[model samples]
Target: MIENDCSDLFVQNFSFWKHLTDTEKQFLCDNTAPVHYFKGTNVHNGNSDCIGVLLIKSGQLRTYMLSEDGRDITLYRLFGGDVCILSASCVLDAITFDVFIDAEEDTDVLLINSAAFRQLADQNIYVKCFGYQLTAARFSDVMWAMQQILFMGADKRLAIFLSDEISKSGSNEIKMTHEQIARYMGSAREVVSRMLKYFSEEGIVELYRGGIRIIDKKKLHSLI
Candidate 1:
C-alpha cells in the first residue's frame, strides 16, 4: 500500500480519477503502491509480470521491445505526470506482443495492481474508456516509429530525431551517444556514426566528446 497521500497525484495524472465513485477511489487507493527504480533498471521484461498501470511521479521510463536479432528499439517514453498503461498489457487482451519497460533515469511511480485496475475497468465505463483511449494513443506512437524505420531515410530520420530531442529538452546540445541514437532509431551504430560525420562535414552539427551540438537548425530541418 502507498505510505503517503497520493490522492492528489492520482487525480492529477489519471483524468478519470475525479469521475470515479467513492468505492472505486477507495479500491485504487488501497491497491496502489509507490515504487522507485534506479536508472537502467528493468521494470518489466517480456510481458512476464503484470505490473499494472504506472502513474509516473518523477523521472522517465523507456518502453521498448527486442528485435528478433536482440536489439532494443524504443517504442515510446514516459515522463513525470504521464500515465503508462502499456506496463499492464497482460491484463489487456488486445496487446499480445512482448514489451519491455525500463527506467531511463532514477524514477518514482505509483503502481495500481493489475487485477484491481482490471476489475475496476470492467465495472466502470469511464475507467474502461480511459484505458482504451490511452492505449490507442500509445499505439499511434508505435506506428509512427515503425513508419520512420520502414519508409524514411536514415538522414531524414536522424534529422527528425535530433530536432525532436532539441525541442523536447529545449537545448541545442543533445547528450546521447551514437549507439544510443542507433538504438532509438533501430539502426546500426556504424550507420549513425557515418551520418553524424556527414552532418558534421556539412556544417549542420558539431560532434563533441559525448554529445552533438546543433550548428545550423535550418540545415537540419531541411533534411526532414
Candidate 2:
C-alpha cells in the first residue's frame, strides 16, 4: 500500500497534478500501484514488459540495454523523487528499442499504469508536455552514455567514473566489485580487474576486496 505521505508525494511529482480534474485525479489514483523491488530485481525486462511510469519513492534504479552476445551497458539511473517514463515506451510512439530497468538496491516505486497514463496524456496537454520533456531528458542521458562508450577510452572513462563516484558519495572509497564496475562501463570483469591492477600499481588507487579507494586524486584526474 502507498503510505499517506508517499501517495501525496507521488501525486505531487506530476506538474499537472494541480490542474487535474477531480475525476481525472480519482482515475489516476485508482490505476496507480505501489510496488517494492528487492536488490538486483529486474523491474522491466527489455521490451517484454510494459511496467508503466515509475515514480521512485526510495532506492535506486539502473536503466540499461543488453546486447545479443549477453553483455549489458548501463544507460542511466533513477533515484528517489525521480519519475521514469521510459518504461512506458510501449504507449509512446517515439521509443523504438528495448531497454531494461533493474533495482540497483531495494526500492519502493509508485507505478502509474501505462494505459491510464496514455489516456491522460492524450486528453491533457500539460501531462503530454511533461512526458515529452522527461523523455527528452532521458534520451539526452542515453546519448551521453553512447558518446562515452564510442569516443572515450576505458582508462579515461574509469577515471571519470571514480571521480564522479567520489563526488556523489563524498568519499574516496568506492564499495563496488570489479564485475559491478565492468557492468557500468560495458566492459568485461577481466578488463576492469586489469585496469584496477594498473591503477593500483601506479599508486593512483588502492584495490581491496570488493572495493577501490582513490589514493591519488591528482593522478586520477590526469588520466581523464
Candidate 3:
C-alpha cells in the first residue's frame, strides 16, 4: 500500500500511478523521499553528478542552461504534478550535460533515487509507459518552442504568452513582469517592453504596474 504521506504528495495527480499494482506502489513508497526548497535556491546545478528523478508536488521550478559567455536559456518550467528526468542521457550513456535547475518559487518535490526508479521501470509496465509518455511530451514541447523561435517574431511569441497566461489564470490580469516574460521567451526585457507597448497601442493588451490585463484575446491569438 502507498503511504498516506507519499500518496498526498507525489502520487496525487499522477494518473498513471493508479494503474500500478499495490506491490508497485508499496515499492515506490518505500524508496522515495520528499524534499523542499525555498525560492531562488538551486535544486541542482549544471555538471553535477547524476542522482535521481524529481516529481514536483507544489510551486514552480525552472531549468536553464548557461553559455560560456554567461547567458541563460530558459529551458523548461515545472509546475505542480510535473516530473523532471534530470539526467536521462547520463543515466543511459554515462555522460552528462550542463543543465541547471532552480526553484522558481518555494517548492516541494519527491526525489526517487535512480536505482529504485530504474528497478520500478524495469518491473512495472505502468511505470515504463508513464516514462515514455512524459519523455514524448517533453520532446514535443521543446520542438514546438524551437519552431516558434525560428518562424515567429518576438511580438507574436509575447502575445501568445500573455494569452496563455490569461487562459491559465482564468483572468486577464497576469501577475508577472516583462522581465519574467522575457526570460521565458528567451529574449531581451527591452524587446518584451516594446512589444507590450505595441500590443497596448493595438488594443491587444493593457499594461499595469504589477501585471498585464488582456484586452483582446482574439487579436492576440490571431497574431500568434
Candidate 4:
C-alpha cells in the first residue's frame, strides 16, 4: 500500500480506461492506489505471495529469472498500458509463477486490489473482454519469444530484437547496455559484446557509451 497522487495519471491513457464503463472506471479510481519505484528496484520477487494486478502508468520493468549459475534470463519488458500477470493470476487462482520483476527505469504503477478487480469483472462485460484480450496478447508474446529461442540463431535473434526495439521506439538509436542485451538475448554479456563489436566493424551499427545506434538498417535487416 504505497500511495501517490494519481489524478494526472488517471486520464493519461484515456482509451484504456475508457474501455471500461463509467461505473467501472469510478470503482477503480476509488480503490486503486498509485505506487512509485526507482530504477533498479524490485517490484516483486519470484514465488512471492500473490497480490493484485499492477497496471503500469509510466516507465519500464523487466520481468526475469535467475539461473542456477547466476545468469539473468529476461522474460519481457513491461511498459505503460501493460499489466503484470502476478496480480491477475492471484485474483483468479491464488497462484502464480515464480517470476522476478525489476524496474528498468523509475516507474509508476496502479495497484488494483484483487477484490476490486473481481467485483468489476463480475459486473462489467467490457472489463471481462479487455482482460481476455490482454491475456491472449501476453500468451502470444510468450509463444513468439519461445519460438525465437528455440528456432532462431543468436545473430538472427539479436537482429530481430534490435529491429523490434527500433520500431517500437521509432528510432534507430537504442539505449541499452551489453548486459541488458545479454539478458534479453539469453546469452553471455561477453558474447553479446563480441557480437556488437563485430557488427560495428562491419558498419552495421555504432556502439555508444550506454547504447547502440543502428547505422545500416538495410544490412541489419538482411541479417535477420
- Writing each residue's lDDT as its tens digit, candidate 1 over 106-204 gives 999999989999999898878888888899999998999899888999999999999999998999999999999999888899999999999999999
Q: Distance (Å) between predicted and true CA of 109, model 3?
A: 1.7
Ranked candidates, highest lDDT first? 1, 2, 3, 4
In candidate 2, how many Å is residue 114 off? 1.1
Q: Cα RMSD to native, each candidate?
A: 2.0, 2.3, 3.2, 4.3
What tens digits encode model 2's per-residue C-alpha lDDT throughout 1-224?
A: 43465448856688888777877777888888889999999999987889899999999999999889889999998999999988898878877887999999999999999999999989988888888889999999999988878898888888988998899889999999999899998877897888889999999999888899999999999998
Q: Which residue pairs collide in model 3, if any? A: none
Question: Which one wins on lDDT?
Answer: 1
lDDT score for candidate 2 against the true structure:
0.88
What lDDT is obtained when candidate 1 is compared to the true structure? Answer: 0.90
Candidate 3 has an lDDT of: 0.77
Which TM-score value belongs to model 4?
Answer: 0.77
lDDT of each: 0.90, 0.88, 0.77, 0.76
Query: Over 4 Å off in model 1, which ranges?
Result: 1-4
Query: For residue 59, what is the lDDT in candidate 1?
Result: 93
The runs of at least 3 residues in candidate 4 whose Cα sits more than 4 Å from the true structure, single-residue gaps closed, are: 1-26, 94-96, 122-129, 168-172, 208-211
Per-model TM-score on C-alpha atoms: 0.93, 0.92, 0.80, 0.77
